[model samples]
Target: MGNIVKERKSRPVNLDIKTIRFPITAIASIMHRVAGVITFVSIAILLWLLSLSLSSPSGFETASAIVDSFFVKFVLWGILTALAYHIVGGIRHLMQDIGYFEELETGAKSAQVAFALTGVLSVLAGILVW
Candidate 1:
Protein backbone atom coordinates (compact mmCIF):
# COMPACT_ATOMS: atom_id res chain seq x y z
CA MET A 1 0.00 0.00 0.00
CA GLY A 2 2.86 2.35 0.72
CA ASN A 3 4.45 1.62 -2.63
CA ILE A 4 1.26 2.52 -4.54
CA VAL A 5 1.33 6.20 -5.46
CA LYS A 6 -2.05 7.86 -5.11
CA GLU A 7 -3.08 10.13 -8.01
CA ARG A 8 -4.33 13.54 -6.85
CA LYS A 9 -7.75 14.50 -8.15
CA SER A 10 -7.86 18.09 -9.23
CA ARG A 11 -10.58 20.30 -10.67
CA PRO A 12 -10.76 20.21 -14.46
CA VAL A 13 -9.09 23.13 -16.21
CA ASN A 14 -11.52 25.64 -17.65
CA LEU A 15 -9.59 26.47 -20.75
CA ASP A 16 -11.98 27.14 -23.60
CA ILE A 17 -10.74 28.78 -26.79
CA LYS A 18 -14.19 30.10 -27.72
CA THR A 19 -14.82 31.54 -24.26
CA ILE A 20 -11.63 33.61 -24.32
CA ARG A 21 -11.86 37.31 -25.05
CA PHE A 22 -9.69 38.05 -28.09
CA PRO A 23 -8.30 41.45 -28.88
CA ILE A 24 -8.76 43.20 -32.22
CA THR A 25 -5.27 42.27 -33.36
CA ALA A 26 -5.86 38.60 -32.56
CA ILE A 27 -9.22 38.69 -34.32
CA ALA A 28 -7.60 40.25 -37.37
CA SER A 29 -4.97 37.51 -37.41
CA ILE A 30 -7.64 34.83 -37.19
CA MET A 31 -9.63 36.45 -40.01
CA HIS A 32 -6.48 36.56 -42.11
CA ARG A 33 -6.06 32.81 -41.75
CA VAL A 34 -9.74 32.15 -42.61
CA ALA A 35 -9.49 34.41 -45.65
CA GLY A 36 -6.40 32.61 -46.86
CA VAL A 37 -8.16 29.26 -46.81
CA ILE A 38 -11.18 30.72 -48.61
CA THR A 39 -8.99 32.25 -51.30
CA PHE A 40 -7.08 28.99 -51.75
CA VAL A 41 -10.26 26.99 -52.22
CA SER A 42 -11.67 29.63 -54.58
CA ILE A 43 -8.65 29.18 -56.84
CA ALA A 44 -9.65 25.60 -57.54
CA ILE A 45 -13.18 26.65 -58.45
CA LEU A 46 -11.88 29.39 -60.72
CA LEU A 47 -9.52 26.99 -62.47
CA TRP A 48 -12.31 24.50 -63.04
CA LEU A 49 -14.46 27.23 -64.53
CA LEU A 50 -11.62 28.32 -66.78
CA SER A 51 -11.07 24.79 -68.02
CA LEU A 52 -14.76 24.36 -68.72
CA SER A 53 -14.95 27.62 -70.64
CA LEU A 54 -11.93 26.66 -72.74
CA SER A 55 -13.02 23.11 -73.58
CA SER A 56 -15.58 23.84 -76.33
CA PRO A 57 -18.57 26.02 -77.30
CA SER A 58 -21.01 23.87 -75.32
CA GLY A 59 -18.63 23.83 -72.39
CA PHE A 60 -18.32 27.60 -72.60
CA GLU A 61 -22.10 27.97 -72.54
CA THR A 62 -22.35 25.73 -69.54
CA ALA A 63 -19.64 27.64 -67.74
CA SER A 64 -21.33 30.91 -68.58
CA ALA A 65 -24.64 29.61 -67.30
CA ILE A 66 -23.01 28.48 -64.09
CA VAL A 67 -21.43 31.88 -63.63
CA ASP A 68 -24.75 33.58 -64.27
CA SER A 69 -26.51 31.60 -61.57
CA PHE A 70 -27.31 33.52 -58.35
CA PHE A 71 -25.62 30.97 -56.09
CA VAL A 72 -22.42 31.01 -58.10
CA LYS A 73 -22.42 34.81 -58.16
CA PHE A 74 -22.82 34.93 -54.39
CA VAL A 75 -19.99 32.48 -53.95
CA LEU A 76 -17.79 34.48 -56.28
CA TRP A 77 -18.58 37.66 -54.38
CA GLY A 78 -17.65 35.96 -51.11
CA ILE A 79 -14.36 34.77 -52.62
CA LEU A 80 -13.56 38.29 -53.83
CA THR A 81 -14.39 39.70 -50.41
CA ALA A 82 -12.09 37.18 -48.80
CA LEU A 83 -9.33 38.06 -51.26
CA ALA A 84 -9.67 41.77 -50.54
CA TYR A 85 -9.56 41.28 -46.77
CA HIS A 86 -6.66 38.82 -47.05
CA ILE A 87 -4.65 41.32 -49.08
CA VAL A 88 -5.30 44.10 -46.58
CA GLY A 89 -4.49 41.87 -43.63
CA GLY A 90 -1.33 40.63 -45.34
CA ILE A 91 -0.14 44.21 -45.86
CA ARG A 92 -0.79 44.94 -42.18
CA HIS A 93 1.19 41.85 -41.18
CA LEU A 94 4.05 42.93 -43.41
CA MET A 95 4.01 46.37 -41.78
CA GLN A 96 4.04 44.77 -38.35
CA ASP A 97 7.04 42.65 -39.38
CA ILE A 98 8.83 45.84 -40.49
CA GLY A 99 8.33 47.31 -37.00
CA TYR A 100 5.83 49.96 -38.06
CA PHE A 101 2.83 48.78 -36.03
CA GLU A 102 4.57 46.83 -33.30
CA GLU A 103 3.23 49.02 -30.50
CA LEU A 104 -0.26 48.21 -29.17
CA GLU A 105 -1.86 51.51 -30.20
CA THR A 106 -0.39 51.48 -33.69
CA GLY A 107 -1.21 47.82 -34.15
CA ALA A 108 -4.85 48.41 -33.27
CA LYS A 109 -4.99 51.40 -35.57
CA SER A 110 -3.51 49.39 -38.41
CA ALA A 111 -5.99 46.60 -37.88
CA GLN A 112 -8.91 49.04 -37.94
CA VAL A 113 -7.57 50.59 -41.12
CA ALA A 114 -7.28 47.18 -42.75
CA PHE A 115 -10.83 46.29 -41.76
CA ALA A 116 -12.23 49.59 -43.03
CA LEU A 117 -10.43 49.29 -46.35
CA THR A 118 -11.59 45.74 -46.78
CA GLY A 119 -15.18 46.68 -45.99
CA VAL A 120 -15.18 49.44 -48.60
CA LEU A 121 -13.63 47.26 -51.24
CA SER A 122 -15.92 44.38 -50.43
CA VAL A 123 -18.92 46.65 -50.92
CA LEU A 124 -17.55 47.72 -54.27
CA ALA A 125 -17.02 44.11 -55.26
CA GLY A 126 -20.58 43.24 -54.28
CA ILE A 127 -21.93 46.05 -56.39
CA LEU A 128 -19.91 44.83 -59.34
CA VAL A 129 -21.03 41.27 -58.81
CA TRP A 130 -24.70 42.21 -58.72
Candidate 2:
Protein backbone atom coordinates (compact mmCIF):
# COMPACT_ATOMS: atom_id res chain seq x y z
CA MET A 1 0.00 0.00 0.00
CA GLY A 2 2.80 2.45 0.87
CA ASN A 3 4.71 1.75 -2.36
CA ILE A 4 1.54 1.99 -4.46
CA VAL A 5 0.69 5.41 -2.96
CA LYS A 6 4.24 6.69 -3.50
CA GLU A 7 4.18 5.71 -7.15
CA ARG A 8 0.73 7.23 -7.67
CA LYS A 9 1.80 10.49 -6.03
CA SER A 10 4.71 11.01 -8.43
CA ARG A 11 4.13 13.87 -10.79
CA PRO A 12 4.02 13.47 -14.55
CA VAL A 13 7.26 14.47 -16.32
CA ASN A 14 7.21 17.57 -18.46
CA LEU A 15 9.58 18.85 -21.15
CA ASP A 16 11.80 21.57 -19.74
CA ILE A 17 12.21 24.38 -22.23
CA LYS A 18 13.53 27.40 -20.34
CA THR A 19 13.22 29.61 -23.38
CA ILE A 20 10.07 29.25 -25.43
CA ARG A 21 10.85 29.89 -29.09
CA PHE A 22 7.70 31.04 -30.86
CA PRO A 23 7.44 31.39 -34.61
CA ILE A 24 7.06 34.68 -36.50
CA THR A 25 3.37 34.20 -37.18
CA ALA A 26 2.74 33.69 -33.49
CA ILE A 27 4.44 36.99 -32.56
CA ALA A 28 2.68 38.85 -35.37
CA SER A 29 -0.65 37.45 -34.20
CA ILE A 30 -0.01 38.66 -30.66
CA MET A 31 1.06 42.12 -31.88
CA HIS A 32 -2.06 42.36 -34.02
CA ARG A 33 -4.17 41.78 -30.92
CA VAL A 34 -2.25 44.42 -28.94
CA ALA A 35 -2.48 46.97 -31.76
CA GLY A 36 -6.22 46.35 -32.01
CA VAL A 37 -6.52 47.25 -28.35
CA ILE A 38 -4.56 50.46 -28.90
CA THR A 39 -6.79 51.37 -31.83
CA PHE A 40 -9.85 50.81 -29.70
CA VAL A 41 -8.50 53.22 -27.08
CA SER A 42 -7.79 55.71 -29.85
CA ILE A 43 -11.43 55.53 -30.80
CA ALA A 44 -12.33 56.61 -27.29
CA ILE A 45 -10.01 59.58 -27.64
CA LEU A 46 -11.72 60.51 -30.90
CA LEU A 47 -15.10 60.39 -29.24
CA TRP A 48 -13.92 62.69 -26.48
CA LEU A 49 -12.61 65.15 -29.02
CA LEU A 50 -15.85 64.99 -30.98
CA SER A 51 -17.88 65.70 -27.86
CA LEU A 52 -15.67 68.63 -27.02
CA SER A 53 -16.06 70.05 -30.49
CA LEU A 54 -19.83 69.57 -30.51
CA SER A 55 -20.67 71.35 -27.27
CA SER A 56 -20.32 74.97 -28.67
CA PRO A 57 -18.02 77.37 -30.44
CA SER A 58 -15.97 77.83 -27.29
CA GLY A 59 -16.07 74.10 -26.78
CA PHE A 60 -14.62 73.62 -30.22
CA GLU A 61 -12.01 76.23 -29.50
CA THR A 62 -11.17 74.58 -26.22
CA ALA A 63 -10.80 71.25 -27.96
CA SER A 64 -8.60 72.83 -30.57
CA ALA A 65 -6.44 74.36 -27.84
CA ILE A 66 -6.28 71.06 -26.05
CA VAL A 67 -5.17 69.28 -29.20
CA ASP A 68 -2.43 71.83 -29.73
CA SER A 69 -0.98 71.14 -26.29
CA PHE A 70 2.08 68.92 -25.68
CA PHE A 71 0.03 66.25 -23.93
CA VAL A 72 -2.45 65.92 -26.79
CA LYS A 73 0.40 65.78 -29.35
CA PHE A 74 1.98 62.97 -27.33
CA VAL A 75 -1.27 61.05 -27.35
CA LEU A 76 -1.54 61.56 -31.10
CA TRP A 77 1.97 60.18 -31.47
CA GLY A 78 0.95 57.03 -29.63
CA ILE A 79 -2.05 56.57 -31.91
CA LEU A 80 0.11 56.99 -35.00
CA THR A 81 2.66 54.54 -33.65
CA ALA A 82 -0.06 51.96 -33.04
CA LEU A 83 -1.48 52.49 -36.51
CA ALA A 84 1.92 52.19 -38.18
CA TYR A 85 2.82 48.97 -36.39
CA HIS A 86 -0.60 47.46 -37.04
CA ILE A 87 -0.42 48.30 -40.74
CA VAL A 88 3.09 46.86 -41.22
CA GLY A 89 2.40 43.75 -39.19
CA GLY A 90 -0.83 43.19 -41.09
CA ILE A 91 1.05 43.34 -44.38
CA ARG A 92 3.51 40.74 -43.12
CA HIS A 93 0.56 38.46 -42.32
CA LEU A 94 -0.74 39.01 -45.82
CA MET A 95 2.63 37.96 -47.19
CA GLN A 96 2.47 34.77 -45.14
CA ASP A 97 -0.98 34.10 -46.56
CA ILE A 98 0.56 34.18 -50.02
CA GLY A 99 2.94 31.26 -49.15
CA TYR A 100 5.81 33.41 -47.95
CA PHE A 101 7.73 32.52 -44.76
CA GLU A 102 6.37 28.99 -44.82
CA GLU A 103 9.63 27.47 -43.67
CA LEU A 104 10.32 27.39 -39.94
CA GLU A 105 13.71 29.07 -40.18
CA THR A 106 12.61 31.61 -42.76
CA GLY A 107 9.49 32.33 -40.75
CA ALA A 108 11.53 33.06 -37.62
CA LYS A 109 13.89 35.36 -39.50
CA SER A 110 11.05 37.13 -41.23
CA ALA A 111 9.31 37.67 -37.93
CA GLN A 112 12.46 39.27 -36.51
CA VAL A 113 12.68 41.45 -39.59
CA ALA A 114 9.03 42.43 -39.28
CA PHE A 115 9.49 43.35 -35.62
CA ALA A 116 12.45 45.54 -36.44
CA LEU A 117 10.64 47.21 -39.30
CA THR A 118 7.61 47.93 -37.16
CA GLY A 119 9.78 49.53 -34.48
CA VAL A 120 11.61 51.74 -36.93
CA LEU A 121 8.50 52.80 -38.81
CA SER A 122 6.47 53.40 -35.66
CA VAL A 123 9.24 55.60 -34.30
CA LEU A 124 9.33 57.55 -37.52
CA ALA A 125 5.57 57.96 -37.50
CA GLY A 126 5.68 59.15 -33.91
CA ILE A 127 8.35 61.74 -34.65
CA LEU A 128 6.52 63.09 -37.66
CA VAL A 129 3.06 63.13 -36.10
CA TRP A 130 4.11 64.47 -32.74
Candidate 3:
Protein backbone atom coordinates (compact mmCIF):
# COMPACT_ATOMS: atom_id res chain seq x y z
CA MET A 1 0.00 0.00 0.00
CA GLY A 2 2.81 2.44 0.81
CA ASN A 3 4.63 1.67 -2.45
CA ILE A 4 1.42 2.00 -4.39
CA VAL A 5 0.72 5.44 -2.91
CA LYS A 6 4.26 6.61 -3.63
CA GLU A 7 4.00 5.40 -7.20
CA ARG A 8 0.69 7.16 -7.65
CA LYS A 9 2.21 10.39 -6.40
CA SER A 10 4.97 10.07 -8.97
CA ARG A 11 2.70 9.32 -11.87
CA PRO A 12 3.44 10.77 -15.31
CA VAL A 13 2.48 14.36 -15.79
CA ASN A 14 -0.73 15.16 -17.58
CA LEU A 15 -0.60 16.45 -21.16
CA ASP A 16 -1.23 20.01 -19.88
CA ILE A 17 2.48 20.78 -19.73
CA LYS A 18 1.97 24.19 -21.29
CA THR A 19 -0.04 25.37 -18.31
CA ILE A 20 2.84 24.72 -15.93
CA ARG A 21 4.89 27.75 -14.83
CA PHE A 22 8.42 26.98 -13.80
CA PRO A 23 10.63 29.11 -11.55
CA ILE A 24 13.16 31.54 -13.07
CA THR A 25 16.17 29.37 -12.31
CA ALA A 26 14.43 26.32 -13.75
CA ILE A 27 13.63 28.28 -16.92
CA ALA A 28 17.21 29.47 -17.24
CA SER A 29 18.63 25.98 -16.69
CA ILE A 30 16.28 24.50 -19.28
CA MET A 31 17.07 27.19 -21.84
CA HIS A 32 20.79 26.73 -21.23
CA ARG A 33 20.61 23.04 -22.19
CA VAL A 34 18.38 23.77 -25.19
CA ALA A 35 20.70 26.51 -26.44
CA GLY A 36 23.65 24.21 -26.10
CA VAL A 37 22.00 21.66 -28.37
CA ILE A 38 21.02 24.32 -30.90
CA THR A 39 24.59 25.61 -30.98
CA PHE A 40 25.90 22.11 -31.58
CA VAL A 41 23.63 21.52 -34.57
CA SER A 42 24.34 25.02 -35.84
CA ILE A 43 28.07 24.25 -35.91
CA ALA A 44 27.44 21.63 -38.60
CA ILE A 45 25.64 24.12 -40.83
CA LEU A 46 28.35 26.72 -40.24
CA LEU A 47 31.08 24.25 -41.16
CA TRP A 48 29.32 23.40 -44.38
CA LEU A 49 29.00 27.06 -45.25
CA LEU A 50 32.66 27.69 -44.48
CA SER A 51 33.79 24.78 -46.65
CA LEU A 52 31.61 25.91 -49.54
CA SER A 53 32.93 29.45 -49.31
CA LEU A 54 36.52 28.18 -49.37
CA SER A 55 35.92 25.90 -52.40
CA SER A 56 35.78 26.95 -56.09
CA PRO A 57 34.53 30.36 -57.20
CA SER A 58 31.12 28.92 -58.04
CA GLY A 59 30.92 27.34 -54.61
CA PHE A 60 31.85 30.66 -53.00
CA GLU A 61 29.15 32.45 -54.98
CA THR A 62 26.61 29.86 -54.00
CA ALA A 63 27.49 30.22 -50.31
CA SER A 64 27.26 34.00 -50.56
CA ALA A 65 23.94 33.78 -52.31
CA ILE A 66 22.58 31.49 -49.59
CA VAL A 67 23.54 34.07 -46.97
CA ASP A 68 21.77 36.79 -48.91
CA SER A 69 18.54 34.84 -48.80
CA PHE A 70 16.13 35.84 -45.97
CA PHE A 71 15.62 32.26 -44.77
CA VAL A 72 19.32 31.51 -44.36
CA LYS A 73 19.89 34.86 -42.69
CA PHE A 74 17.12 34.13 -40.22
CA VAL A 75 18.60 30.74 -39.35
CA LEU A 76 22.01 32.30 -38.80
CA TRP A 77 20.45 34.93 -36.58
CA GLY A 78 18.70 32.24 -34.55
CA ILE A 79 21.99 30.41 -34.05
CA LEU A 80 23.62 33.62 -32.89
CA THR A 81 20.83 34.22 -30.43
CA ALA A 82 21.22 30.72 -29.00
CA LEU A 83 24.97 31.19 -28.73
CA ALA A 84 24.57 34.49 -26.90
CA TYR A 85 22.10 33.08 -24.39
CA HIS A 86 24.20 29.99 -23.73
CA ILE A 87 27.33 32.04 -23.08
CA VAL A 88 25.59 34.40 -20.69
CA GLY A 89 23.89 31.58 -18.83
CA GLY A 90 27.15 29.69 -18.61
CA ILE A 91 28.79 32.69 -16.96
CA ARG A 92 25.97 32.86 -14.44
CA HIS A 93 26.47 29.19 -13.61
CA LEU A 94 30.18 29.82 -13.14
CA MET A 95 29.39 32.57 -10.65
CA GLN A 96 27.19 30.20 -8.76
CA ASP A 97 30.09 27.80 -8.63
CA ILE A 98 32.09 30.48 -6.80
CA GLY A 99 29.21 30.97 -4.30
CA TYR A 100 27.64 34.10 -5.76
CA PHE A 101 23.99 33.00 -5.99
CA GLU A 102 23.92 30.16 -3.53
CA GLU A 103 20.74 31.40 -1.97
CA LEU A 104 17.51 30.16 -3.54
CA GLU A 105 15.88 33.57 -3.99
CA THR A 106 19.05 35.26 -5.18
CA GLY A 107 19.67 32.48 -7.70
CA ALA A 108 16.14 32.76 -9.03
CA LYS A 109 16.39 36.55 -9.37
CA SER A 110 19.76 36.31 -11.08
CA ALA A 111 18.29 33.80 -13.49
CA GLN A 112 15.49 36.22 -14.34
CA VAL A 113 18.07 38.90 -14.96
CA ALA A 114 20.02 36.60 -17.23
CA PHE A 115 16.91 35.69 -19.15
CA ALA A 116 15.96 39.35 -19.63
CA LEU A 117 19.47 40.28 -20.76
CA THR A 118 19.52 37.42 -23.25
CA GLY A 119 16.33 38.69 -24.88
CA VAL A 120 17.72 42.23 -25.19
CA LEU A 121 21.00 41.10 -26.73
CA SER A 122 19.31 38.66 -29.09
CA VAL A 123 17.04 41.43 -30.42
CA LEU A 124 19.96 43.82 -30.93
CA ALA A 125 21.92 41.16 -32.79
CA GLY A 126 18.97 40.36 -35.05
CA ILE A 127 18.50 44.04 -35.87
CA LEU A 128 22.20 44.54 -36.59
CA VAL A 129 22.42 41.45 -38.81
CA TRP A 130 19.04 41.45 -40.55
Model 3 scores a C-alpha lDDT of: 0.92
Task: Encode model 3's per-residue lDDT on 3-118: one tens digit a residue.
Answer: 55434466777689888888778889999999999999999999999999999999999999999999998998899999999999999999999999978899998898898899
lDDT of 2 at 106: 77
Misplaced by over 4 Å in model 1 are 1-19
Candidates 1 and 3, the one with greater lDDT:
1
* Candidate 1 lDDT score at position 124: 97
RMSD of each: 3.8, 4.8, 4.0
Give the Cα-based TM-score of candidate 3 against the true structure.
Answer: 0.83
Q: Whose TM-score is greatest here? A: 1
Better of 2 and 3 by TM-score: 3
User: What is each predicted model's overall lDDT from 0 to 1?
Assistant: 0.94, 0.82, 0.92
Candidate 2 versus truth, CA RMSD in Å, comes to 4.8
The residue-level lDDT of candidate 2 at 85 comes to 75
List the lowest-lDDT window of 10 residues for candidate 2.
1-10
TM-score per candidate: 0.84, 0.69, 0.83
